[model samples]
Target: MPGTIAFVGDSLTAAGRWDEWLPEFTVSNHAAGGATTADVLAEVDVVLANRPDAYVLLIGTNDLAWRKSVEHVVRNVESILATVHKHEPSTRMLVQSVLPREPEFAASIRDINRHLWQYSSTVRAQFLDLWPVLADENGALSPVHSEDGLHLTAAGYELWLDALRPAIERLFAVPTTTTPIDVLSDAISVSGLR
Candidate 1:
C-alpha cells in the first residue's frame, strides 16, 4: 500500500508540489510562508491530526532570519519530534538539513544543520542533508537553486524531490519479519523515546 507523507516547515516546504513529484504516495504540504520553528511547534496538532504515515520537515531558516540562536531552534525541533513520537509512534520521519542561504548566515545555517543531523540519529529519524546538493562552492545557496537566495526555484524543487525519492522508497518498502509500521512502533517503544 502507498503511504501518506506530510511536508511540514516554512516557505521552502510550502512552495513545493510534492504530489506531482511523488505520485506513488499520498503527499500533503503543510507548510506556510515566513514560518519559523515556533510556528511549526504550533502546527504540531494540525500536522499530527492528519495521521500521516510519514513526515518530512525542513524548518529553522526563518528562525535564524528572525535572530533566534541555532541552539534555540534545535531545542524547539527536538520538542517537536518528541511530540510527534508521543502522538504517532509508528510514523516514519525524515528531517532535512536547513538549506544554505546568503553568505552572511552561511556558517550559522551549517551549524544548525549539523546539530539537526546528529539529533535526528539520536531520535531515530533519518537526516537528509540538503547542503551538499544545494550549496555552491563558496557555501552559499546556489543561484541556480534559488532566485531570491532563499526560496527554491523550479530546478531546486526538482533537486529536492530527486534527493528525497530514494528515502521514500526505502521507507515504504515491504518488510520481512513484520509489517513496517509495527516494527517502527515496537522500536520506538523499546527506545523509550515516546
Candidate 2:
C-alpha cells in the first residue's frame, strides 16, 4: 500500500533525503534552494502533474527573508494551497510552519507560522509546527541542529524525520508496527526522491 509523497518548499524541504528517511513510500522532492512561495506557485503545475498522494509544503521563509510582509507570505501560501486543492482535490496536504531563523527574524517567523496555522483550516490541510523541535529556547535555530542557522545539520534532519514519520504514517495508513528500518527494505528505487 505504498503511496507517492512530494515535498515542496525551499532548501529545508529540498535538502531532505526523504526517500532514505521514509523508505516505505515513493517520495518526490520538488523543493529548490532559495525558493519562495511565488517560485513554488510558478512551478506547481509540474508538481501537480506528478499527482502525489500527499504533499509536504515548507516554503515562505525565503519570502520573509526577502522582507515580504507576513500578509504577503500568507496570501501566497494560501494561494499555493488553493492551487493544490483546485488541481488535486484529494491530495493530502501538510503545511509546515516556517522554521525559525536567526534571533533577529524569530518574531516574523512566529507571526507567519501563526497565520499559516490558522490558514490550514481553510484548506483542510494539517499545519505542522516545527518550531518547538527545531528552535532553541531563545526561539532561534539551534546551533546543534544547524551550522548556518538556516540549513539543517544531521541532527536537525533526524529531528525532522522523527516528527514527519507519524504524519506520513497517518496519511498513508501505515501501521505503527512497521519500523523505519523495515520500511527501508521495502524501498523503491526512484532516482530523484531527494
Q: Each candidate's lDDT (Cα)?
A: 0.83, 0.84
Model 1, residue 146: distance off in Å is 1.2
Give lDDT for model 2. 0.84
lDDT of 1 at 133: 87
lDDT tens digits, residue span 1-194, model 1: 58899999999888788898788789899999999899999988898999888878999999988999988999998888777766676677788898888888888889988888888866557888889988997777787888989989999888888888887776656332223455777999999998
How many collisions between residues are there in candidate 2? 0
State every prediction's TM-score relative to the real structure.
0.87, 0.86
Q: Which portions of model 1 miss their true places by more than 4 Å?
A: 174-194
Task: lDDT for model 1, please.
Answer: 0.83
* Model 2 C-alpha lDDT per residue in residues 129-166, reported as the tens digit of each score: 89998999778888889999888999999998888887
